[model samples]
Target: MNIAFQDSKDIDKEQVMKLYNDVGWYAYTKDASTLNNALRASLDVISAWDGEELVGLIRVVGDGLTILYIQDILVLNAYQNQGVATQLMEQVMQKYEHVRQKVLLTEEASDVRHFYEKNGFASCDKGSLVAFAKLEG
Candidate 1:
C-alpha cells in the first residue's frame, strides 16, 4: 500500500466526516460544521492518504510549546493495523519533539493502552501524574 502523509488542516469536510463515521465516531460526525471548525482551529493536523483516499488522521490542540494535547486520531476500518496510525503519530512526535508534555485521553481498553505504550506513552496512573476531564452533555 502506498501511503502519503500531509501536515495540514485543509482536508475536505466530507472526507473528514466519512473517515470519522467509518470508525464509529458518530459524536464527531453529528455536526459537520462544528467538526470542520474544530479541525480548522487545531494547532496541528497530520493525515494519511492512500492516493486520494483519506485513510487516517491525527490532530492536536495546544500551545505547541509547553504542552500538546492529542485531540483525535483515527484510521479507517480497512486501514487499521497497517501502520497508518503509527505513521501519523510518528509525524506528530517529530513535530513536537521539543515539547515538554505530550498527552492524550482515550477509552480505557487493553489494546488502546498497549498501542500508546508501544509508541512511548506511559500511563499517568502508573506514575505520580493525574489526569482529569469534563464532558458536556
Candidate 2:
C-alpha cells in the first residue's frame, strides 16, 4: 500500500495501456499513439504508482488561466477506495488553486456522483452551468 505520487506522464507504454484497459477505458487504449500524444498535451498530469504499476491518474486540460477541464481520473479497481485518487486530486487542486473554473464530466451513478461531490465538484445541473459534448467514432 505504499503508493508514490508524481507530477509526471513518464509512464511507459505498457503500464499506461494496462491501466486504461483495467479501468475499462478501452477507447483510450484503442490507439496507443493518440493516447500518448493526448497525455503529453495535457495542462498537468498527476499520477499514483505502486512501484512500477500505474495505480491511479488525474489529468487536466484547458487554458491555464480561466478554465480547466479534469480530463480523467482513474484508479485501478484494486486500489479504488484507498485515497489514491484523492491524493492525485489534491495535487491538481494545489497546482491549480488560482484557477477559477474546474470542470469534470462522468457517468451519473451514485458512487461516481458522490465521489466528485466529495471532492468539491458540483453537478452542472445543480449550479448555474451546463455542459455538452459530441462524440464520434
Candidate 3:
C-alpha cells in the first residue's frame, strides 16, 4: 500500500468528522463547526491516504513547540495492521521528536500499551490518569 503522510490542510472537515463518528471513535451527529475548531487547534496532523481515500489520521494538539499532546490516532478497520498505523505514528513522532515532552492517552489495553511503549511512551504507575468531557450543548 502507498503509505504517505500529508498535512490535513486539504482534508474535508465534514468528511473526517463523519468518518470518526462512523468508526465509533466519536459520537454520531457531529457538526462541522466543532471539527473546524479542532483542526484549527491542532498543532500538527498526519494523514494516510490511499489514492484519494483517507485511510488513517492522527493529530498533535499542543503549544506547537514545547509540549505536544498526541490525539486522535485512528485507522480504518479494513486497513488495520499492515503498518498503516505505524507509518502514521512514525510521521507524527518525527514531527514532534524535538519537543521536550510528548504525551498521549489510550485505553488500558495490553496491545495499546505495547504500541505506545514501542513508540517510547511510558505510563505513570504512582499517579492515576483521569479524563472528563462535556459535550456541546
Candidate 4:
C-alpha cells in the first residue's frame, strides 16, 4: 500500500468526488456540482492513495492563521484499519501547527472522539467558547 498526501491543487477532482460520496452519511451530499467549489475553498486537503487509487481524504476548512476546523476526515472502507486516517490528520495538523484554537464537529462517534483525542483535542468543559449554528437559512 503506497500512502501519499496531496493538496487540492494536486488532487484529482473526480477521485475526491468519489471518495466524498463513498462515505455517505458522515459526509452529507447535496449535489455533485459543488465538489469543485468545496475543494477549492478548503484551507488544506490531504489525501492518501494506494498506488493509483484514492483510499482516504481529509479536508481542513478554516481560517489558516488561528482557527482550523477539520471538515471531512474520511477513509474508504477497505483502508479503515491501516493508519490512513492518522496519516491524513497528521498532515492536516502539521499544516496548522501554529493554530491556537482548532475545532471540528462530528456525529457523536466514539471512535471519532478517540481520534481527535489522539490528535491533542479535548472536550471543552471550562465554559470557554460555545458553538452555535444557524439551523435554517
**Leading candidate by TM-score:** 1
Question: Each prediction's TM-score against the native?
Answer: 0.98, 0.95, 0.82, 0.84
List, residue by residue over 1-137, the lDDT tens digit for candidate 4. 77877675467766777777777732344554566678677888777888888888887887889899887788888789789998888877787789987888776678877887888877663357666555552
Better of 2 and 4 by lDDT: 2
- Predictions ranked by lDDT, top down? 1, 2, 4, 3
**Candidate 2 lDDT, tens digit per residue, 21-69?**
9999999999999999999999888889899788989989999788999
Tell me the alpha-carbon RMSD of every candidate: 0.6, 1.0, 3.1, 2.3
lDDT of 2 at 68: 91
What is the lDDT of every predicted structure here?
0.94, 0.90, 0.75, 0.76
| Candidate 1 Cα errors over 4 Å, as ranges | none
Off by over 4 Å in 2: none
Q: What does the lDDT read for residue 133 in candidate 1?
A: 88
Q: Which stretches of candidate 3 lie over 4 Å from their true place?
A: 126-137
What is the alpha-carbon RMSD of candidate 3 to the true structure?
A: 3.1
What is the overall TM-score of model 3 with all chains considered together?
A: 0.82
Better of 1 and 3 by TM-score: 1
lDDT of 3: 0.75
Q: Which candidate is the best by lDDT?
A: 1
